[model samples]
Target: MNGPSLAIRQRSLGDLTAEFPLFPPLTRGCPKSSTDEIAYPLEVGYDYARVDPGLFDQTPGTDIARWSPLLPPLAAPTLGEGGTPLVEFEGIHFKDESRNPTWSHKDRLNRVTVSAALAAGAPGVVVASSGNHGASAAAYAARAGLRAIVLTSADSPPAVQAFARAYGARVVSVPAEARWPLLREVVDRLGYHPVSNQTVTHTGHPFGPEGYKTIAYELFLQLGQAPAAVFTPTGYAELLYGVWKGFVELKLLGLTGTTPRMFACEPAADGPHARALATGAPAAIVETFPSAAYGIAGPVGGHRGVLAVRDSGGEAVLVTDEEMRLAQRDLAGQGLWQELSGAAGVAGYRKLRREFGGPVVCVGTSSGFKDLGVGAQTYPVLEHPTLDDLRA
Candidate 1:
């Protein structure tokens, strides 16, 4: 099935002003209008006049690109990225995104961003990620027959590094602070389409988050109504913003009555979004400490996250490493093993004691195998096993 021919426009999040013809992914660090003071992630909006509501009624199946009227116009390469199972356990529904092709929610983002790279005629793609994002981007780029360069910190998980390399992507390890600068240099010199952020405030790829909207769409379709709240593990807040935007679009189309409250879950060691919200700033930077959930440990918070939380009447919640560990164990007991960072949503949900009174979804972003510490366990070795030892 082909998507409807729709014209794309770039709208500034700082102001309501929009510009036609989406060119140059990030204009001067972020999508901006002439009069905007704060630079924010440019929203990819469509001319709704050309859209037919009936088009959305078509079964999207596993490929999210099927909802093309609400997405950028491009032929995306899909590896069964979407249509993950929404499982219910202990009064909370879990959007198990670990079932994706790359075992992470990032496959949704990479599917669209890699297509953007192909549409723009870029040589390849470049991304900076410690784990899931890099692996997913490499997989998509490989599917599209394009070169992929993955930049990650030197201390990134070896399993994740191997996953990227297994997809035939060039993996480079650099200092945590040098990844972004090197990404920009590659984009400028090699003309590689950057699938990650290059700006100081972390305005991610324009087309990337649009893919995440499918999660919200799926939730509405499955439940036939909006949930009370959506808890998501946040780094740059791309998924949080994208999911909120999806709910807003549904309300705008009159398909849904209202949007759900969004919760941004971050590690307590580095809760830049929380800090930004407390300070009432568009963005904020903080010194990050080590945590078991390194995949979502971002030192800088972006304006996109703040907007999603504030607009949805939601708040940011910080979870400690211990809290996340407990949540991970809880998910495991429910037959869902998630990475420490992937369990942040559950941790946040537990931290917030308010009664939601309705269905609540916590996004499980990745599988437990992505964590570097997952492979360190060893079984006891015995020359002879006795009945007592077996019982013990």
Candidate 2:
């Protein structure tokens, strides 16, 4: 029950040369490589040698707090965020994150970020997301009794926006370009803790992805070892990197012999991760087009994502809207109605078209209810007729 963190410091992902203390978390990006104009993300560093080997012997519990030693200091109470099932569907493994409190994997990230806000004694948290991130931030901030501000675009999923507002968050609709700037002002001027990305190249909260590492721990427990490959639905590749980091920690602890290959699944319309890898950049920006899988169609890629694919010897695979649609339907056939973006992993896995010697996992990030237009259909009423009409 005592899951105190062993986190010591943070290292920059830009060049891995910059270092900073863990506490008073670097809400901004790496100071060495990041300026007001250019930004680079940082990774949390833990005193892994000090980690108790007995942690592996214990049953991986229902929430992220079970492995807090390997992560940053957790400051928020759990809303029952981890322990998602890794189910076999369509001849492959599917990590179902929809069972989380927010019906999305973002719950895991928020559990840590909101804790950062509470630890900093910040009054509220600010996030620039129109999807799961916004909703999850609102939910967790409310649970922690902190005010939340969600800045979204007008075209975001209606249900997702409703989720933020329903949680009593102050949701504001603004043009897409204005979100980050507004978020900056909220963080600096208004003194609100930013639970989302504030950097230009998508370095989210330093402690947020630490929350996502729990998924890998659960997978290791469920599968009895590391899988051969993990396919993640990536916007900034935070989940991809976090999962990889967990396995890396396991290997460092002399548990697993090797780590899984991390495959980042992104929308073809906006292949930030894929393009960033191709260019060998820490991060990159690309023009984006709206896709039904809106969650992973991010314009900016992150250093965390670049590190994940490259170090894991994995590649970024772009999935089309049609491909994801088929994958979504495929999951639905297996009784998992995931959001369109949630199907990116399976879509990427199928697109890879190579046989792996071991088990492969595709992450389903959210429920179908989080997608656009879930409850908007209006049905036509049938006219009253004779009882024989019913039989007909």
List, in order, the clash count of every candidate structure: 0, 0
> Candidate 2 on 1-392: residue-level lDDT in tens?
45788989988887687888887878778888886545777788988778888887766556788888887777788888888888898778999999999999999999888988988999999999989999999999999999999999999988889999999999999999999999999888998999888787888888888888888888898899899999999998889988999899889899999899999999999998899899887778899987888888878888888889999999999999999999999899989999999999999999987877888999999999988888998976668877787687
Which candidate has the top score in TM-score? 2
Tens-digit lDDT string for candidate 1 (1-392):
44663646777776665554576566334444322334577878877766677765755468886777787765567898888899997788999999999999998888888888888899899998889999999999999999999999888888899999999999999997898889989988999999988766767787778889989889988777899999999988999999999999888888888889999999999998999899998877888898889878978888889999998989999999999999999999999999999999999999996787688999999999998766768977977989998898
Worst 10 residues of 2 by lDDT: 56-65
Candidate 2: residue pairs that collide: none
Tell me the RMSD of model 1 versus the true structure: 2.0
Scored by lDDT, the top model is 2
Judge candidate 2 at residue 296 and give its lDDT.
Answer: 82
